[model samples]
Target: MKQPWIHNAKTDWWFILSPPFLVLLIIFVFQKQIQGLENHYSFYTWLFLIVFVDVAHVYSTLFKTYFVKAEVQRRKLLYLGMPVISWCLGIALFQFGALTFWSVLALIAVFHFIRQQYGFMRIYARFEPDNWSKKIDEVAIYTATVFPMLYWFKTPRAFTWFVNNEFDWLKNLPDYIGVITVLYILIVTVWIIKTIVEIIKTKTVNIPKTALITGTYLSWYFGIIYY
Candidate 1:
């Protein structure tokens, strides 16, 4: 029988991935206070945030794509054309405006991050048959990942996705965002309570799923707040 907290060797979630990510989160949170880092901090952030995680996550697909000959053959057109199409789209967006380019890219990155959590949840729940559990997992992860983004849009922070006042357009939208933010917090609280109750009833846990949710919550919350 599969244990609730861990999988066998073939399915272990590689707990090793969490520590370095948490370290990165800590570094990101305190970046501005580091005196000598004023000029070079962006470089390190780009290295860790962009190169290490962002770019590495993209290439991580190699395991499911190019490495599997049959899968490659199945998605041959997608594999062959996505790069070229993405390149063209990128140039077009940049030409439209650098702000347009970066904003769209940042939005896409958020979508990727959200989907990655869903994917991990699916993997961790592969043996689970309870749809309610899956649904709650989705809601919790989405709340954790997306609330920070809502916070960012409503309250500007030290970091920005684009330059040259490109996002100034958003400032004039409305004032009811405060209400929405409160509702968001309430919903997140409810989800947490629901999850805890379910865990008590089941008397078991999915360790990897729990880790992903916690990491997403911590990272997104701190990343945006500190940004």
Candidate 2:
């Protein structure tokens, strides 16, 4: 049977598979250069990564949703009210304190990122039967992301989500981090072993799903842990 791709093979490959892998590839290729840019051209680097890329992603959402007539009509309340609701919520958060606002927003952004990754995985796997292998993929993907974030919450890190010390408001559990790390390792190993066995059994691989799962694992590992 032909592979069931959401937007056909090539488009899905470029959009989903290429991006995270490319990010890792680019960083590995330019690690020293990236460091130098952060050290010296810090402002420009922020502009490129956050302003050009991150904020641009927000703007790009319009083309896919708000700009589409059916999408807008399907969720008029969502499209219309969400912005105002978000604005009011932000104001409320800000009233708490600057750090509180940032901390809350940062955590929400992290949660969104985690959900978005899982969303793509679910979409790619929709054609497959819901079974043990599928469950492994789900758990593996979540662990790939949540493990790093749990590390972020439970331990001190050299990085920040948005601004400095944004995660300080989170509970710290340095003592349990080791145990969490072990659990993360076991899950990931099981995923790898099961994936290999599945491939051998079926004599095929789901490219989009496999790439997304592995890409997420590597991305979170390097972004949250290795960095």
Q: Write the per-residue lDDT of candidate 2 for residues 1-227, one digit (tens) a residue.
A: 35658888899888778888898898999999988878898889878988998789899988999889999999999999999999999999899889889998888998899999999999989889999989999999999999989887766676676788887656653467888889999999999999999889999888888888999999999988888
10 residues in a row with least lDDT, candidate 1? 8-17
Q: What stretches of model 2 exceed 4 Å from their correct place?
A: 64-74
Lowest summed lDDT window (length 10), candidate 2: 167-176
Give the Cα error of residue 184 in candidate 2, in Å: 0.8
Cα lDDT tens digits, model 1, 37-140, are 64558779668867897689678989989899999899999988898999999998899877778778877866887787777666766787868767777778
lDDT of 2 at 220: 92
C-alpha RMSD by candidate, in order: 3.9, 2.1
* C-alpha lDDT (0 to 100) for residue 55 of candidate 2: 86
Structural RMSD, model 1: 3.9
Please give the lDDT score at residue 92 for candidate 1.
Answer: 88
The alpha-carbon deviation from the true structure for residue 54 of candidate 1, after best TM-score superposition, in angstroms, is 3.5
- Per-prediction tally of clashes: 0, 0
lDDT of 1 at 94: 92
